[model samples]
Target chain A: MSTFLLILITGIGLGALYFLVASGLSLIYGLMGVLNFAHGAFLTIGAFTGLWIATKVFPNPTTWTFIFSMFAGGIAAGLFALLMEQLVITRLYNRHIDQALVTVGVSLVVTALLGGWFGFDARFLPTPLWFTKAATIGDAIIPVDRFIYIGVAAILLIAMLSILKFTRIGLIIRAGVENRSMVTALGINVRLAFSTVFFIGGFAAGVGGVLISVFSYGVSPLMGGSWLIYGFIVVVVGGMGSIAGSAIAAMLIGITNQFANYYVTGLGDFVVVIILAAVLLTKPTGLLGKVSH
Target chain B: MLRWKYSRPLLIAITVIFAILPFAGDNPLSKAGLQQTMAVAFLFGALALTYDLLFGFTGLLSFGHALYFASGMYVTAILINDFNVNFLLAILIAVIFTSLLAVLTGGAALRTTGITFAMVTLAFGQAGHVVIARDFGGFTNGDDGLPVNADRLPDFFIGVVNTKYLYLLALGILVFIYFTAWWITESSAGRVFAALRDNEQRVSVLGLNPNRFKLLSFVLSAAMAALIGAAMLIVSGSGSPRYAAADITIALLLMVILGGPVTRWGAVLGGIIYSVLSTRLTVLSDGTAFDSLPNFIGGPLAEPAFTLGLIFILIVMFAPGGISGAYYRARFKYLNKGK
Candidate 1:
């Protein structure tokens, strides 16, 4: 019973990170109508940025460093995405097939670039000195870092949702998703909305990087493919353009992965994909089914 | 002149030139270098045609259609290696099975269009890759790649020693398949697919159901990819789980975009250029300062993702229609503008 609980908690923790990543992807898809294939690469960039900060800047993964490093990573990733949009996304506007080709191409380029940047050999950063090594409850043992990831993800998610719901920028983004042309017609500068959404997406991914790397204990070039697929699965299964749906789908995918790892010994890696396929097959509109465009 | 574009003779001429060129040469060219490259190009062209039918015609971009290609390769391997079947029988079985798999998956995938469909397809493709990778004993041989015996092939047929026949066979199949795709693309159904690509709602309102057309395109595309997989196996003699994954799909997508998506010859040319530039250049060439630069730029750039980044940057910056598209676009403009 307790093992299940520990797993659930762990799943929720990583699930939170997945939510952040998927939400960014969902928003990008909702707004731009192109699947941002480079989103996972951005996550990796963010994580690597955090790692760089931890090692180069702070020498320890303290709370202060963790918080600041994530923001720094987010800024780098956001700027990177803005440049990509200006160059590639602008050309791809209204051409869905071309957009798909371009985005997939961009993903490959990003992955290739990151692979060169990080090298094929995976890299890691040590656990922060401040956080306790482990947490125990009865027969269950969980890493405190996992909980920290969950906390960080939760904090970021809440902050993002609030901004989306409450802010004028959020309203413009919401308006943009529904009618991009009208937003422009209103003299609202839809470009700014795009840039803001891009930044938010990149920022969420940046924070997700720190959370995810700690769980995996290392970061690798190969991580982008898996993460991209997972994020897509989450967004798709939850429905396309819904933030709430992303959260729900992330938890489902995350928990399913954790449990599948435990129960399905050999085919552990394939379960998420199979489950997602099944979901998509059964519910083509996905769980939320809100986004039509 | 208009009829000559997709005419059977032109395609036949192209195929025969490719087919005879291998045996026509001696020494260096005799070693099946260009032969293999053309074979692979035709094979990939066939795959890209399938992608174009899905992307160019039906207005779908299936990110994971390579699953069918991989499935065909693996199934062919299974027939030859496990069940001791002949190549023709194996390929036939692969095509049929791949079609069925496509129908089952495409039924679900075609329900969603654009990004959602891409994701759904990718999910299934990755699922297939993962299953193959994990199953060490039964299917995939756990990433070492499942093997097919050359001993199964007869003595006149390279004794498994000669890959030249395989190259010619691949070219033959490619020409055959390319014509098949060309015929379909020019057909009324193909027009419907094109309509769907331009505007699904308008097509539907015209009483042509977009979903049905999308489903049909997906199935046909899958079957074509399966055939390509058969050629891939014959040429390389093996199919890894890796070949059927998202990575290969990216390669095929790139092939299509580079070629100018809707054009029949363009796709083939794109595949040929990419295959020659990527495979033959690295595999057959004597190590030299000149050859090394392209490899260093495209090959030893080491890391699957970096090549993607470089290609994306280049395609977006300069070669928007891919190399073939860019070439053709420039030529047309030069000729017409000068006139």
Candidate 2:
């Protein structure tokens, strides 16, 4: 029973990370009709930048320093994403296929550049001591980092939901996701929304990157690629444009992965693939997906 | 620009030149080192041609092609090494198995079009990669990789002295694949494929099931990729987990785009050029030439992927039609000038 509880909590932590990456992917695909291959690059950049700050600026980081590094990572990644939109993605506006291809190119170049710069090895980040501590709840002793992940993820989710619910940009984005042509016809400058969506997605991915580094205790050039695949799966399973759907799907996949890995050894990844296939075959539109294309 | 009357002769001439390249005297072409490189180039060229059949002709942008290729490589290697099967029979069995696998996966993936299809295929491909890396049932041997057993009854295929046979074999595979792609593209089914690419709804209106044609193209492309995989195992003498990576499919995409999609030879050209550049760049990176340059500038230049990826982005931005598109444009302008 204790083991089950531990696995369940751990899986939620994993799911939290997935939601961070998937939220951005879902929003971008919803608004722009692009599968951003460079999203992984954004995550990688965030992770490396966070590492740089923790190691260089604050060799012995306090809680405040650590939080600052995380935000710094997110902001850097967000700016990079904005530049990508203004420079590369904007030029091929309306050409969804070319946009995807260019993103793929960007991902390759960024990953290669990171590998060249970082020497392709995993570098452990400096964390606050409390992050390494554990909390005892009943018979289940949970690592404090899991709570931090869950906490940060919950805050971000609420923040995003509120932004979507109340803001002007949020209204435009919601309408744009429904009918991009209609939104344009309404004269609301959908292009600005496009850049905004990319920035938000990049910021989420960057934060996710920092959290992932904390979870794994290190950062590597190729780390983002693996997580990005899961993010893609979550986006598809959760529906293309739905945040609530993504959160639910993320938890489902994460818990399933943990249980499968525990019960059958090397079957965790295989089971996740099975789930994806099942979902795709049964409901191609995903759990809450409205768009048929 | 060569007229239609001369294009056929020019093609034959090019083929003859490649066929006889191994005997071109003491230059780089005649050496064993270069022969191996060219053989790899030919293998990729064939693989790219198969990819072209899907993306260029049929408009299916699949991202999991490496799954089939890796299946062919690993299956053949396992059969030969573990079961002690003959190399030829192993390859034959691997091809058959991969075709069935392709049918199953392709059937499922073809249910979605465009980006969804790409993602579905990617999931399947990643599944294959994981399975291989995990060493399921101890068949794949995990990340250490599986090397081909040379004693399994093929003399000409083994040893450095007989690199020419491997070279010729690669050339033969490339030629066979080229003609097969050509035949398929020129057939009535190929016409339907072109139509499907342009407009799937119209193809359905014409009373042909677009899904079936797409499945056909998918299976054919996958099976051919598997064959290339088998050939690659023989050429390189081993199979590694990298064969199943998503990056391989991306590289194939790069080749198709670089050579100019829709034109079969353009894919082949892209494949050849990419393979050569990738191999040579590694050698260049390891050399002392970059030692004198600044770290920031030299570091990126040392990685071939950076340069290739930059070029890929530029091409997608500027030259949507690739090298073949450029050639066609120049030819059109020259002919109009003559008038």
Candidate 3:
């Protein structure tokens, strides 16, 4: 029973990271109608940024410092995404295949650049004092970091939901996702909305990257590629643009991956891929995603 | 019409150039190293041509086409090494096996369109990589890869090491694939493929089954990729799980896209140029020429994947039509000026 609890907690911790990454990917794909392959690169970029801030810029690290670094990472990714959108992605709208190719190129370039600047060596962020301790509940020991991950991810998820449900910008984004042409017809600058959403998505990805890096206690250049693939699977399985679906599917994936890894080594990713294929065959639109094709 | 006419003469000239490239060195038969490189280039050419068949003609952006190629490589390697099957027979069986695999996967993949198809293929391709690297370690040797030695082949051809024979074989296979691609593009079924590319709904309106034509192209492309993989086993004498990697598929796509997707000869040219540039650039970067530069600027820029990614971006942004498109426009302008 304790083992199951530990596994469940581990699953949630990882699922939170996936949710953070996939939400951005899903939102961007939903609104912009283009999947940013470089979304994963943003996470890597953010991880490096947060790591840099934590280590170099703020040497005297604390919980507040760590939190600040995560935001710095998100802001950095957001700014970069804004620049990339203006310079590259905005021009290729509606051209799906071209957009995909270009984004893939972006992903490759970003990954290479990261690999070049910071060698391929993995870097670990310093764990905060609060996270270094573990809480024991009924014979099951839960690390403080896992609880932190769950808490932060839950907050972000609720914040995103509230924004989407109640905020003006959120309403516009929702409208844009439903019908870009209709939003344009209504005199909304759809491009501006897209750019804004792109920034938010980038921010989310960056935050996720920082969180995952901290959770795992190591960050590497290749992390983005693997996470991006997982994020793609989550988004596709959850249904593109569906935040709730992404969260739910991410949990499913996280749990499955944990169980699979515990039972069978190296079979986790293969099972996820198989699940994706199955979803594509039966639910082309995803579990909660509207059928576009 | 004029473009097709021009393409024929142009293709012949390109073929002639490729046929003579190795012999242009000091001695006709002694340039084994160069011949080996060109053989690898031709193998890439075959890959690019097959990719163009799907992306250019059928309008399918498959991110996992390497699965088929890797299937052929692994199957051929296994048959030759484990089963003690004759090398030639293993290749034939590998091709048939991969074609059937393509049919099965393509059937399911074709049920979706555009991005979904791409995602599905990506998953399948990754699955291939995972399975090869893990589950089938007994058969595949996992991440370590399976090596084919000279003794694995028949006495007729000295395996992989005899660069001369491998070069000729690669060239012969490339030529065969080029013509096959040409014939497919000019056939009635090829017309349907083009129609599907232009407008799937319109093709359906015409009462043509788009899936049938797509599956045909997919299987053909997969079979051609398998043939290249078979040749790769002969040339490289090993099958790495890397063959099924997403990077390999991406590189092949870049080759086709850089050449102009719809143009068969262009894809061949793209393959040759891409292969040459990648090999040469990696060598140069690792050499002493760039050692004086600062690490920040020189280190990342010197990496081949970084350079290639930058080039890919530039092509996508400034020259989406690629080299062939540029070539066609230039020739059109030249001929029209005389008229």
Candidate 4:
């Protein structure tokens, strides 16, 4: 029973990070129509940025300082994304294959540069000043960082939901996703919206990296790729650009992955693919997502 | 420039070069640098050409084509190691095995269009990755990969031309695949795909069921990729899951897109240039021509992906016709001038 709870906790913890990363992907793909292959590379870029800041710029690398460094990483990824858009993404706006191909080039370049700079090695931030121990409750030992991850994911989810619901920017974003043609036809500057989407997408990817470091506490250049695949699976299975779909799908994936890892030793990935394939076959539009194709 | 067209002579030129280049060295050609280079280059050319069949001809942007390639190589390696099958027979079976896998995958993947298709394909590929890593432990040798030696081949096959012969084999397969793809593109089926790309909805309305054509293209693409994978094992003499994973697929796509997706020879040229540039960069010293070059140009501006990304950006923005597109246009202009 305790083991189940531990798995459940870990699942949600990891799922939340996935949700954070995927929400932006869902939005970008839905709104801008760019697949954003470098989305995960941004996460890796964030990890490196945070690592650089945590080690170099900060006076004292406290937990607070580490958090700030991660925040910096998010911002750095966001800026990197904006630059990408201004140069490359802007051109391949309507062509899906071209967009995918260009971003792939972007992904390759980012991963290679990181590989060269970091040498495929991992550099973990020094353990936080506080919250290093696992807390035991009712015979279930949970890492405090796991709880932290859950909290952060939940907070971010709530914050994103609230922003999308209440904020004008979020309102415009939702509108843009629904009817980009109509929105642009109304004489609105849709390019600005695309730029904003790119920034948010890149930022979320960075934060996901920071959040995921709890389980595997290190930053490797290749770190973004595995999670990138998971994030895409969640977002696509949930429906390409549906916000609520991503959250629910994240939860489902999280639980499924946990169960698969525990029960079926070697078939975890196989199960995930089967599930995705089944979904693609039967529910082409996704469960909650409107069938666009 | 004379190597521009896909003429019969051009094809023969390619085959002869591929066959001879690997053997154009001192005795004990297996240790020859040319053999190693030809072997790698031939397989890569095959891989890139197979990718071209998918992206260039079918208008499918797959992010997981490497899965099939890997599948072929893995099965072939296993057959050699466990059953002691002859190398040629192993490759034939590997092709069929992987082609079946492609048919199964393409059946489902063909249902979705555009990015959803790309995502679904990629997810399945990842699943293949996981399976290879954990479940196929005995067969794949897991992440360490399976070591394929000369024992896989028949004793009479032994010569100073192991890698050289592999290069010839890969080149033969690549030629057949490339010509086959070119023929398909020029055929009525290829016309349907081009029409589908222009407006899939319209094609559906026109009573041409696109799903069927898409499936066919997907299968062909998978089969072609499988052949490349088999060739890779023959040349590299081993199988790494990573080779047939998303990474190489993405690289091949980049070269295809950067060159010109619609052109017959664009992918070929694009692949060669991209591979050469990449090899130069990683293998070169920091002070070498390429090391300081892409960095000096790309970094002084912004990110590195920025420059390569920008090249595509320009192509998409200003020159949607691609490099080969320009070549075709120039050829047309000259033809008109002659007329």
Candidate 5:
């Protein structure tokens, strides 16, 4: 029972990271019809930026300093994404495939540049001492970092939901996803929404970068690639553009992964693939996805 | 029309040149170092042509084509190494197996269109990558990679002294795949594929099953890719996990785009050019050429992907039609001037 509890908590912690990446992916894909291959590059840039700030700028970071560095990473990633939107994505406009290809190119360049600058070796991130400790709950020992991850992800989820419910920009985004042409016909600047979506997605991915670095105990140029795959799976399974759906799917996948990996060793990834195949075959639009025209 | 008029003679001339490249006397092209590089280039040329069948001709942008290629490489290598099967028989079995795998996966993946299709295919491909990397049932030998058993091989395919034969074999495979692709794209079914690319609804309205033709294209393309994989194993003498990776598929996409997607010869040209550039750039990066420059600029120049990726981005943005497109445009301008 204790083992189950520990696994459960750990699964949720992993799922939190997935949600952070997937939320942005879902929203961006929903509004723009792009898969955004460069989303991983944004995460990578955030992680490296956070690493630089914590190590080079802050020098021996405390808890507050680390938090500051995380936000700094998110802002950096957001700005980079905005530039990408203006320079590359806007030029392609409605050419979805071309946009995807360009993003693939961008991702390759960014990853290669990171590798060239930092070498391909993994660099450890500085962490607060408390993150290294564990907490006990009814015979279940949980890492303190897991709680932080869950807490941070939950807060972001709520904030996103509230904004979508209340804000004017969120209203435009929602309308844009439902019927892009109709929204455009109504005299809204859909292009601005595109930029906004890219920035928000990049910012979220950047935050995910810092948290994932903390979760994994280090950062590497290739770190974002694997997590980005999981984020893609989450976005697909949860229903593209649905944040709540993404949250649910991420938990489902993460929990399944933990339990399967525990019991069967190397079969966790295989099981996830099976789940993906099954979901795609039976429910192609995903759990909450609308039938797209 | 002009392209079609000269394409045949051009192809024949190019083939003749490649056929005699190994015999070029006292030249760097005939050396073992360059021979191996050209052999790999030929293999990529064939692989990229197969990708062109799907993406360029059929208008399907599949992100998981590497799955079939890896299947061919691993299955053939495993059969020859562990079961002592003849290399030829192993390749045949691997090709059949990969065709069936493609049918199963492609049928499911084709249910989605556009972005969803890309995602589903990526998932399926990544599943294959994981299975190979994890060494399921210990058959794959995991991430350490499985080297082909040279002792079980034929005499002509054995050592560095016979690299010329491997080079010829790769060229032969490339020619075979090229002709096969050419024949398919010129046939009635090929017309249907082109039609499907332009308008699926129109085909459906004309009382044809669009899904069936798409599946056919997918399977045929996958089978060709598998054949290339088997040939690649023979050329390189090993099967690594990277064969199943997404990067290979991306590389194929780059080749197809760089060459010109719908143009068959363009894909082959793109693949050969890309493979040669990648190999040569690595050699250049290792030398003292970059050492003369400052650290910041020189460091990135050493990484081939940085340069190649920059080139890829520029091509996608500026030259959406690629090399063949540019050539045709220039030819048209020259002809107009003459007139």
Candidate 6:
């Protein structure tokens, strides 16, 4: 029973990380109608940036310094994404297939740059002193870092949902996603809304990267490629352009992967991929996705 | 097979060039390394040609075509190595098996279009990589790759050595694939594929099921890809897990783009040039001349794949139609001036 509780917590922690990543991807896909393959590269960039700051810029960094590093990472990713949007993606709007190919090219370039800059070896991030302890909940003991990740993810999720549901910008975004030309016709600056959404998406991916790096203790150039695949799976299974669906799908995949890892060992990644394919076969629209066409 | 009048002569010229390439190694016409490079290029040409059928002609951008290729190689390798199956029979089985796999996956994948289909296929490709690396490691030998014993292979196979005979075999298969692709494009069904590529909704409205033609193209493409895989195995004498991953698919995508999609001869030319240039570029990147450059500038440039990525972006951004399109436009302008 205690092991079950532990597994559940572990799954939720994993899910929270995925939720942070996939939600951003979902939002971008919803509004821009572009599958940003470089989303994972942003995560890698964020984590690496945070690590670089914590170690190189701030010697013997405290918990507060680490948090600041995370923010810097997110900001860096956001700026990079803004540039990508203004330069490359803006030209390829409405051409989804071409957009896919170009984004993949962007991803490769970013990944290669990271590899060249940082070298290919995976490096561990210096853990904040405060996160090294374990927290006991009921009869189950959980790492404090895991709990912190879940807490942070929950706060971000609430913030995103409230923004989307309550704010004028959120309404505009929702409307723009549904009918960009219609929104443009109605005199709403759909382009600005998309840019804002793209920035936020990049920001979320960066934060997710920081969080995952905090837990995993390192980052590599290739790390983003694997996560990008999983992020695609989550968004697809949850339903494209649906944040709620993506979150649910992320949790399901995260949990399944944990269980599969515990029981089946090496087949964990394979099982999740198979599940994604099965979901795609059975539910083309995804679990919570509205019929796109 | 459909003959696009102008390309017929070009195809014959390419065939003749490849036919003579192995013999030209000792002469000033070709370098010693040319034969091996062309052999691998022909295999890649076959792979790109099949991909062209799907993406360029049929309007289906599949990201998991590498899975079919790897499946073909592995099945044949396992049959010949482990089960002592006859080489010819194994090749036949590999083709049939991969096409059937393609049919099954394509049936499901065709339900989605554009990026959704690409992602679904990506998932399959990733899954295939994992399966080869882990689940079926016993047969695949995981990342180390499963090698075919030299003695087990028939007298025809070079068994890991890139030889004149292997080059001939690859060239022969490539010719077959080129002709097959050309014929498909010339067929009425091929016309339907072209129509589907232009506008699927309009074709469906005309009472033609786009999915049926998509499936046929998918199966045909997969069969050709698998044959290339078989040819690769015969040349390299091993099947590696990399064959089942997205890298090969992306490389083929790059080649197709370079050649210009929807142009069969362009894809072949793209494969040959990319294959040759990549090897040369890798050498240049690692050579002494690049060493004198500053670290920041030289670092990324030292990797040919990074340069390829840059070129891919440039092509997608500035010149979507690629070399073939440029040539056609120039020729058309010249002919118009003459008129």
Candidate 3 Cα misplacement greater than 4 A, ranges:
A129-133, A291-293, B4-10, B13-17, B20-33, B155-161
Q: DockQ (Cα-based) per candidate? A: 0.46, 0.73, 0.74, 0.44, 0.74, 0.66
On DockQ, who's better, 1 or 3? 3
- Listed per model, the TM-scores of chain A against the true chain A are 0.92, 0.98, 0.96, 0.94, 0.98, 0.95
Each candidate's lDDT (Cα)?
Answer: 0.76, 0.89, 0.86, 0.75, 0.90, 0.83
For model 2 chain B, where is the 10-residue window of minimal lDDT?
B1-10
Q: Which ten residues in a row have the lowest lDDT in candidate 5 chain B?
A: B1-10
Indicate whether candidate 3 or candidate 6 has the larger lDDT: 3
Which portions of model 4 miss their true places by more than 4 Å?
A: A264-266, A290-293, B1-11, B21-31, B155-161, B199-207, B285-322, B333-339
> Model 2: what TM-score?
0.98
| lDDT per residue (tens digit) for residues A33-83 in model 5 | 888888999999999999999899988878998888889888998999999
Identify the candidate with maximal lDDT: 5
Which residue pairs clash in candidate 5? none
Compose the digit string of candidate 5's lDDT tens values, residues B1-339: 436577789889988887787787877768888889999999998999999999999999898999999999999999999999999999999999999999999999999887778778988998999899998889998898989999998989989988989999999999999999999999999999999999999999999999999999999999999999999999999999999998999999999989988889889999999999999988998998899888777777888889889999999999997898788878788768857
Model 5 TM: 0.98
Listed in order, each prediction's TM-score against the native is 0.89, 0.98, 0.95, 0.90, 0.98, 0.95
What DockQ would candidate 1 receive versus the native complex? 0.46
Which residues of candidate 5, in runs, are more than 4 Å off?
Answer: A291-293, B337-339
Docking class of 6: medium
TM (chain A), candidate 3 = 0.96
Task: List all candidate RMSDs to the true structure.
Answer: 3.5, 1.4, 2.2, 3.6, 1.3, 2.4
Checking candidate 6 for backbone clashes, the offending pairs are B1-B183, B2-B186
Q: State the lDDT of candidate 3 residue by residue for A180-283, as single tens digits.
A: 77888989877877888888888988988899897777889888888998899999999988889899989988888888887888888888889999988998
Q: Per-residue alpha-carbon lDDT of model 1 for A64-108, expressed as tens digits?
A: 777788788788778777887888777667875456556676667
List runs of model 2 lying over 4 Å from the truth: B1-4
Write one digit per residue (lDDT tens) for candidate 6, span A1-293. Answer: 77777777888888888988898888888887788888988888788888888889986878788878888888888888888889988898777767777877888888877776777788878866878888788888877887877787788788888988999999998887677778889898888887888788888888888888877778888877878878888988998777888879988998888888888677779889898888888888789986363
TM-score of 1: 0.89
Query: Cα miss at A232, model 6 (Å)?
Result: 0.5
